[model samples]
Target chain A: MARIIGGLTSSHIPAIGNAIARNLFEDPYWKPFFDGFPPIRAWLDEKQPDVAIVIYNDHGLNFFLDKMPTFAIGAAPEYRNDDEGWGIPTLPSFAGDPRLSWHIIEQLVGEEFDVCSCQEMTVDHGFTVPMQLFWDDWQKKPIRTVPISINTVQHPIPSPARCYKFGQALGRAIASYPSDQKVVILGTGGLSHQLDGQRAGFINKPFDLMCMDKIVSDPELLARYTAHDLVREAGAQGAEFILWLAMRGALQGHVQKLHGNYHVPISNTGAGTMLLENAD
Target chain B: MSTEAITQDIPGTIIFNGEQAMKGYALNKMCYSFNKADSRAAFKRDEEAYMEQFHLNAQQKAAIRARNVLDLLAAGGNIYYLAKFAGIFGLSVQDVGAQQTGMTVEAFKAMLAKQGE
Candidate 1:
């Protein structure tokens, strides 16, 4: 049976992608944020997985208001990055594991998740930034991916409890895959930062820390958070924290958080990253 | 299960739910077109024509014409899509944020720095 090796969670702020593009690491404003990723790069080098299940949101790139899917899974053979209307450097296309994807889709639908199976999808920063953070040169195509997208953009977003439940279903699907491939589940988006309204530059590091603690040790408590509570506490755009619940739900009980990091103002976000290894 | 729970009246923020999604579909579709260089140029060439093509409501047209970020938000323009509109005027989201908060751009940057401290 396929095994879930672990889950990784990180903030997918697009400005970080822009900084990477402009080679801004040596710049003083960026060094602190850039400093956190080298350890992640080294860790991934040690615990390389065959495939990565990337859970991220589409930031007006692939899906628009015309039709939005609350949950979408990439079932294509290859996935590409879109130009996010800001000239952020586009990464190479990601190879998809169709067999694994279809298996998960079958499993999810069987369990009543009703995730939209996407045959073709162009990912935005939410998908690319985390990959870039972990892989020194992600363009080498070292791993295949299944991009799982959830809607935090449109209102009526999935609640934290529902997201965690969906993650648990996802964990079951991954464990039951016919092959022995080792897989990594990644969730990318937020740790308390909003992008709109009169309260635009909102950041709640305390709340973000509260979330990280809950997500690592007591995800169900985090799940108790209503979407309204997330917006109120984590900020409007920071509702992207819902993605982390899905990641937290995917693993078995008591996974050890191997490493973690959090920083603020990564261009209107309190950026955070965490690595959790299943204690199996 | 219904629109009843959406917090649209959360003070100064306009929540973009299914209702707003339908209202701004054409405007957002036009903004999404900015993903390509050609469309950005097409927009820059004839702003009025582009708004006309999108069948933007008078409010949306006025918001676009005046480059008013708050007005756009009230008119159902999602922040991500509005970023494209802001980009044309060389405005970063933080700049837009400053505009929303009624602060000068430099003050917003300083506040962000202070927040980090």
Candidate 2:
């Protein structure tokens, strides 16, 4: 049997990586942002989860503008790091657990989730940005991952209800896995802020706080929201936050808030991070 | 000239151009088609009827009806969605890549290798 040891939600601005790689944490604007992530770092250090089911969206990197799957899962033994033009400074390839990944794949299929499974896939900053913050020496570790890639960048993406249901299904799949491993479900992307023409720098603190509340106490209400509504309120790209509900829905109702940090104007987007322990 | 450019002047067909290329209506249809089990059947039963539901313009409808990947891309159609449409033609993204770039997939791979150097 598997238990969700905890859940983490983080903003994945590529600039954060730039800050880390350049050792610019002491810079006035970047220091607080870097400081905000320590609680998540400490939690991962302590929990040491055996597997991490990372829920994230690809940004026209691996999937490309050619064909995008609504929900794709990476069941490979390892994932290669993608070079999104300028490469990640010192990051190494991510090691994945094939046996556990395959088990979850089988369960998702049995549950009729209709996941797109791949053996040799490359992950972009969507997965790595959070990994860099959560785990120390993550690149060198022998950690296994189950990647759930959502179609966020493209239009006609999965509905919020669909995402929440998928999260519930993933939770069931994880719980039913034969292995006795501790798992951590990471939901990455957004607290608020939108990136696009005219409405480029939009950030709604009230809506973001309301979303945080809905994610924990009332996911059902959040599920009713269309992607259009999120884009309008939080900015177009802000809808990526829907991925968080999948991780939240998979956890126990009550969550222990470990640490949280919120910041704005990071490369034309508002960003935030939150760590939560599942109620046992 | 590219096959797309040649086809753009074809009579009674839509010419995809400029911002219309990124509008994503065709891409949305491609996702909807492949994700739904009965999509192929529905399209086969009545292609125009099925497409009409999207409320696409005359040009979008014509481009989709023509099954033109280049036209779609030119009309602001996303490659991701176009890839799905290519799948319907028993084509892979590599094939579409070759078609769009006017080079063989192998040639493109070699080009990429060179750029990586």
Candidate 3:
């Protein structure tokens, strides 16, 4: 049977993508952020899961204000990287595992998730930054991937409770796929940092730290936080961290928190990364 | 502002919720177009003409002209799309954030550095 081997969560800040594109790992400003990845790379090398179900939100890339899906799954064989204006360096196209994607799509529909299916979609930094940070050779020795785009950019986004439940349902689907495959899920974007308005530069370190702690131990406790509260506390953009709840919910039993890294001011974000192994 | 327009009660931060979406549809659609190099070039070549094509209101045009991040927010600018607009002026997200907070980029960087320490 297919199993979720593990899950990862991180802030997919665009600056991280810029740093990776420019090879700034040794630079002091980016050192702390880059330093966190070696251990993660080692873990992936050790586990070597067959696929990564990347859960990310589009930043005005594919779906626009015209018709935005709260939850969409990529069922394509290959997904393209989008031009998130100002022209961030483009990464190589990602290879997708359509078999696994369709399987999950069937299961999610059976569970009443009502997710949109995207046969063709281009990804933004939210999809690529985490790949660059952890799967450094993703372009060459690329792991097969499935992109699950969530709506965090537009308002009326899915609730934290709903996202968590969706993760739980996803966990069940992954566990029952009836294939001998291992999978890793990524929940990308934010710990705390607002990018707009009078509260710009907002980064509540205490709140971010609390979130990290809760994510490791009692992630469901965070469901109590309304989207309004998340905006108020974690900052506007930082509320995208709700995507982490889906990752947190996907793991079976307890998760062994393997490694975690948190750094501040990575281009208007309190960036964080964590690797969790499902306790089987 | 439309009386029926939706507004979040959050102090200081303008939440880009549904009401703001309706209010800023034209500006955002124009910003979304900035994703293409041709559109970005056209915007740079004739800023006034581009604004007119987007049918931006006086407030949005003034905000775009002044490069005021706060004014853009009040006029319903979503930051993700506006990042493109900011890039035209060589303003990083941090630079725009500093502008919104009424701090110079240096002071803002100092504030961020202090948080890490």
Every model's DockQ, to 2 decimals? 0.66, 0.03, 0.69
For each candidate in turn, the interface RMSD (Å) is 1.4, 14.9, 1.4
lDDT of 1 by residue, A77-136 (tens): 998887777777877788899999999999999999999989989988899889888876
Ranking by DockQ: 3, 1, 2
| Docking quality (DockQ) of candidate 2 | 0.03
Candidate 3 lDDT by residue in tens digits, A1-280: 9888888988888878888888999999999888888998899999888899999999988878889899999999998886777658987788998888898899999999999998998989899888888788887797988999888887887889888889999899889888898899998999898888787787888888888888878888997788878898888888897799888889867688899898987888888888988878
Alpha-carbon deviation at A45 in model 2, angstroms:
1.6
Q: Output the number of the DockQ-best candidate.
A: 3
Q: Model 3: what TM-score?
A: 0.96
Docking quality tier of model 1:
medium
Instruction: Show model 3 residue runs off by greater than 4 Å.
Output: B1-7
Stretches of candidate 2 off by over 4 Å are B1-117
Candidate lDDT scores, in order, read 0.85, 0.69, 0.85
Root-mean-square deviation of candidate 1: 1.7
Model 2 over residues A1-280: C-alpha lDDT tens digits? 8888888888876557767788887898677677887778777878888888889988645675446788889978778764443334536777788877777778878888788888878887788888888885776666678888998866567778888988888888888887788999999888665433223244677787787766766888998997767766676567888899888878864677777766654544556778888867
